[model samples]
Target chain A: MTTAVRVAWLAAALSLTLLLCALSISIGSRSIAVLDVWGFLLRPEETAEAAVVTQLRVPRTLIAVVVGAALAVAGSLMQSLTRNPLADPGILGINAGASLAVVIAVAVTGIASIMFYMWFAFLGAAAAAVGVYLLGSGRRRTATPARLALAGVAITAALTALVQTIILTNQEAFNEFRFWTAGSLEGRGLEITGAAAPFVAAGLLLALLLAPALNALALGEQTGAALGVRVRRTRALTFLAVTLLCGAGTAAVGPIAFVGLGVPFLARAAVGPDQRWSVPLCLLLGPAMLLAADVAGRVVIAPQEVQAGIITALVGAPLFITIVRRRRIEAL
Target chain B: MTAAEMPTHQARLAARRLSVGYDSRKVLDGIAVEIPNNTFSVIVGPNACGKSTLVKALARVLRIQSGEVLLDGSPLSQYTPKEVARRLGMLPQAPHVPDGILVEDLVARGRYPHQGLFRQWSQEDADAVDTALRRARVEQLRDRLLTELSGGQRQRVWIAMALAQMTPLLLLDEPTTFLDISHQVEVLNLCRRLQREGTTVVAVLHDLNLAFRYADHVIVMRSGGIVAQGPPREVISAELIEKVFDLSCRIIEDPETGTPLVIPQNPDTAAKGS
Candidate 1:
């Protein structure tokens, strides 16, 4: 019966996602009809409007969904793995790593392709994850949530400071970063999507597999072990998955903030903390949230789209603060 | 039913000359114990006496430093982690509950060992989870967030999770810690009920009185080694308490159950009496 309920919820969530996606396709700045969006997606060869919709809005909307899901799922994974409700990709320095690496790449080699940025970001994220894991674990038999969060804050602050310094030293690099850091969804082509899709997919898969183990982990290492979970391997895999998801998403979108942090928290409020449900709900709610914000950005000011990232922050910061204030945000 | 009729050689759990510790310090050394089938045994000791450590080692949470734990007489290390989990379940002291986790879902996690990579959810798993929730008496709180439950209620939820594992042997580490007197009795009685239903139960208890009242067998530990082991009346004495706990205590029978109860005499009172 519980499985049935969860399946029903998943089905409902998926349907809602599709509905939101359709609404997103229809409600952009140009206000294309739902029928037109469907026609454009299904049979693009028939009309010019179809071609325009297929070429521009489809990829953009899909990118919003992918980025949203990836970031939120990564955030949720990191939060649970570290047992900290406050944990997110950006707060943990994964995004900082990606952004800094990209800045360095752009500064040194004048490389600006999303592909190059993706690899650079992944490398940086890997380094940061390893660093945090080692520092957080300390001499303890297992890493505690409080230790991991502290380690994340320290490493993230240091990396952010370093990245800021690079931006400060180079005017050209700052000019590029200044625009990208605003977190726009403008002009991100199919190539950016292609570059990020595989990593995001892999992250999604890894997170799904790690969900049950993470559920046990939420009960602490000893209890998790008593339940037969390989806690160390589970934790390592979770960290790796979060790195890939956040790294790839940030590389694609140049650091969309708070979507990762906010969406999963909301998903938890909706579905509860069993990661089997929480993770999948995160995948759905994430993209719905991102696409909703993107659409809001498009229509909130005609012909002048607000960056989806900025919009998410506008919505997310207050909500996150509310959670912190109303509920205890301690590690599970 | 005769002993032979019971799960024969199902010597489901045994520790063989086991030594367990952290870093260079030993916590349990060269101790051999067999958890007899269908018995409720309790490990009782003061704080830091290695009762919990011994249970963790027995459950494979802590690595054995020098010896082996066995299941059905086979080396425990030979069985896969999941295999051991399939037959043995443990409830560690004060598990860190996930925020806003529903009690039902938390209990459902016990089914992880029985689940396969391909089999997501099954009727069998559902039945086991439901049965556990009922047995632990948390069925009414199934939809409630674990955070919303009281301490005893939450503790029961954790036990319910262990029950969901459907294992024959259940180990609990300080399962009654932090509970009020009433709640402590409630939890101990719940363990007794489980044991009566044929689950082999082992618990590390801090309250000697409670252990004496609840356990069929009691193992006392001090400084990483057994101080005494037997039925409570046969083992607990003023001398043993002084030796293990460094306290002068008077041993008396409880007014209700007639179990041995330790009354630590004040040092002043002892001096005055002397």
Candidate 2:
């Protein structure tokens, strides 16, 4: 681990992400050539080959990259913020919160418009995060990481149960929710990507700025304060950033598991617990993972398709296991 | 000394009628103490006597229930945390080490108060970190991970981090508690050296003899109140130890340094009150 090697890894990962993005656009139900994909990317034409590239594959590829990066940032931030190596975006029920809101929207209006429900998902995620924070912050000023995690688990459980009951009773809601709960990128257009990307961008900015402070926080709460970090305010802002990230990701695609949980560990294993390095590395690694999974899913069963979320867990869990077996996990 | 050379100065670091507590229970109340400039000061007391509370309150780790702490002749509350951090550094009791963090990087974190988003890792920060590593005698372990270091080495690295803060005044809460006799002495010696190097050092120490041996100024406490303050030789006596700790002890001289040393009486002779 020299600086040169780390920089090389970053460059390689970025190149891999770009390669995967290109591959996702070309290798799909139609398997367009690289040259044709390039032409379609520059100026989508009237032909059917171009239609597959322009109308369908490109938007999903963009959504996959954006949501993947957002989840990765959210997961890394959540893990460090809670100081729980096991922590991820779903630990605080952001996914469950968004899922519950979307299901409620479907049951009420029977409309599946991305624009209509994305806002509800975002609000629900923020509300759940705020609720967990309120419950976790102790009677006084002490907000232990373990206490906060327990609060998250509790809220996530309650909201998930509510979502399950609502969807089970409403047949139409269940049919609509089933597609999303499977975590597909199919049929999601650029409008969904457009609605989600700004929040993710804002979150990524906040997370990068919060990086050095999170490094100090790895030392512990009292030590963080001793190092002149404003512990309470920093944690609050971290919550806000995580909310935006997880809310937007889960809103755009259904909760894409494994990328958020596994990629951060990969980032930390390559580097140490320095969030300055881990956070940025995660941004590159996350999308590379998701788009690769998305591309693989388009032909995993041939003519039939698996969702990107299913492929990620199927591929990611074993990859995670293999990685941990090779390299010991870093302590938070 | 010339009259102009030895001029009058106010105590830049002092607490006035300070009260601190968690929840409703008060740990320290109406306590006042001043750290002499460029000297090592130690606060010693029985368990639960609020010495740690006093140090933490001064460090601004604990919220003051009433009154105020002043640093550089201004109320500590007036300065932002980073501004206060520029002048004062503290090491909390048994501070945790981030897993897999390298010694140099850990020391570099002391630059937080000085760094902004744009001006990270300036030349001055690099020099400060190097100086800290050399001064704390951890330059040899600069590339070592905290998990690989021995307890004494880890403590020294932590001190290096505080030194890297490059503050004029340093506060440590129970710096020597978890160490063996030799490690305890090692940490205390480092603190004393920092004082000699012109950094004002304040620490809460549990070992009465060690505090007396190392501290130029001492504050003794009982039940959250300041019992005595001044040089350890004048402030600590057999009567004071008995009154404060309920232990019968005799004061003797350290042959090497001629500092006051406390020798407790045998249990057969002193175990009557309980």
Candidate 3:
């Protein structure tokens, strides 16, 4: 595509993302007017609508935006690092691993706090990342994308079953985990968003800085090294960033699936595989998608709501299948 | 045998008693070598004779266990990878091209070492990419998808990427592997042109005839040791070829390039002249 069209597309994506964020704040169950939302955003006041805006919608929007960026960035990083276009935190069992850890944390301590369970999320994500890599590897060589995706599916299935068994047996933990597993933004305040934002931010920063190295890595490891990219270091940093993003994202929202999987695919489809463009594109597209899911969830049933996770799955699974049918193996 | 010394020119990239290998296996054992500046050097050897290992070590792709690589009079370890990359480049044995990537897009990634996080896509980078495309004659193929290109075209695209790095030194490993003989000559010609343009080019080639026909300097290896190193005509003899390759052969001068050409002996006969 021409530069002008690409730039225009980029601008539209940003505007659309901002519009979604605004819509997320404005169109909750009660439906505040856009004028009122704008007014409240401009000037703080002691009003009930302001309270609804500040106390509820704003935090939900922030968490959606943060988690959206984190998951999408993590997914892009995984795809580039593994040379696997099909890679996603959810598909690769990272989210399942985090879910199991959070469940175990709650079952063990009866403490359902974000601060308390997020650490376990990181550990579980690390373990799953390593486990999938080992299992996915092809006969003494590095993992091919097909094998890695299969390994991811296997690991995801196993961990998800373990999560189910734990949640079913432990009633106390089930109460804490059910709302989370559905992946809703309801009843969560700024506290959880605050707890998760820094990690997401760090992961985003690392990803952005490592973008050029990732581009070099696209040309195999030895070539990347010859080009002065520290391959092992870049891979390690990417692993750390992916773990942080997935861990924090899973902890913030209970394993929200498909935002990571689909947004970056859309980003690459729009632009090319250049990480510098796609990664930033993911930041915009990711939130636009999740907030769309979240907003649609609010309006889908009006009073009673479906979870954002359910909506994304409804949308993302078809997209995933289309991608599978469209592309051959490990070409990226 | 020791390499012939040319005390006049200082070698920019040289190794010192380099000993490297996997555990319990020594691939290159205490081999010292110097690569002259602004010349086409080919490392030719039998299978597993450590030619690729030596080139990889000089390119700083593999870790050295017991020796040091010096680039431009400084130990390579002292310079950051990016710093070294500005002066050296390598086109690996089988480099992967990302599917659906345009040739220009793939070539542009060669600017990674020259680029920084905030300082991406400068005028210098664009100029380098253009120059590389022109130099490798792939400028016409700039918009084409890399995967859609022929094997020879893809090889030139990879060489274009290395050229885009704008390094003074370039190393290629079996760059003509999958290409036909004509394409092999095409790649070797490109390397020759690169050498003419004042870039030191080192290629690890399996084809001794092509290696000798094109290389201004040749490093011959046998069983992890440098058997000979000098101009190809002096270094590549029938005796040396037979000793290194265990193949009886006759060394004939190439009529086109006036370089040594190896013709294997007929095993059934013991004739001195054909």
Categorize the docking of model 1: medium
Each model's interface RMSD (Å)?
Answer: 1.8, 1.7, 1.1
The DockQ figures for the candidates are 0.59, 0.66, 0.68
Weakest 10 consecutive residues, lDDT, candidate 2 chain A? A323-332
Model 1: residue A254 alpha-carbon error in angstroms: 1.1
Question: What does candidate 1's lDDT look like per residue over B1-274, in tens digits?
Answer: 2222335355678776789988899888888776777878999777887888889888888888898888888887888778889989988887887877778888999998887679878999989999999999999999888889999999999999999999999999888889999999999989999999999999988888888998888888888887777778888899999999988889999888999999999889789889
Model 1 C-alpha lDDT per residue in residues A1-332, reported as the tens digit of each score: 25677777778878878887877777766666778677777766666677667777778878888888899899999888888888888888788778878888888888667777788889888888888888889987567778887888899899889888888888775676666767777777788888889999999999999888888878888888888898778978988898889888888887887888887887777777778888998898888888888888888888888988899889988988898999867565
Give residue A317's lDDT in candidate 3 (0 to 100): 89
Encode model 2's per-residue lDDT on A189-257: one tens digit a residue. Answer: 889999999999999999999998888777777778877889888998998899899888888888888
Please give, as one word, the docking class of candidate 2.
medium
Instruction: Choose the strongest candidate by DockQ.
Output: 3
Candidate numbers, best TM-score first, in rank order: 2, 3, 1
Best by lDDT: 3
* Rank order (by lDDT, best first): 3, 2, 1
Cα lDDT tens digits, model 2, B1-274, are 2112322246668888889988788898877777879989999989999988888889887789998898987888998888888899998886766667789989999988898888877899999999999989999999888999988889899989989999999999888887899999999989988899999999999999999999999988999888888888877789999999998889999988888999999887656745
| Candidate 3 CAPRI level | medium
Model 1's DockQ? Answer: 0.59
What is the TM-score of candidate 1? 0.93
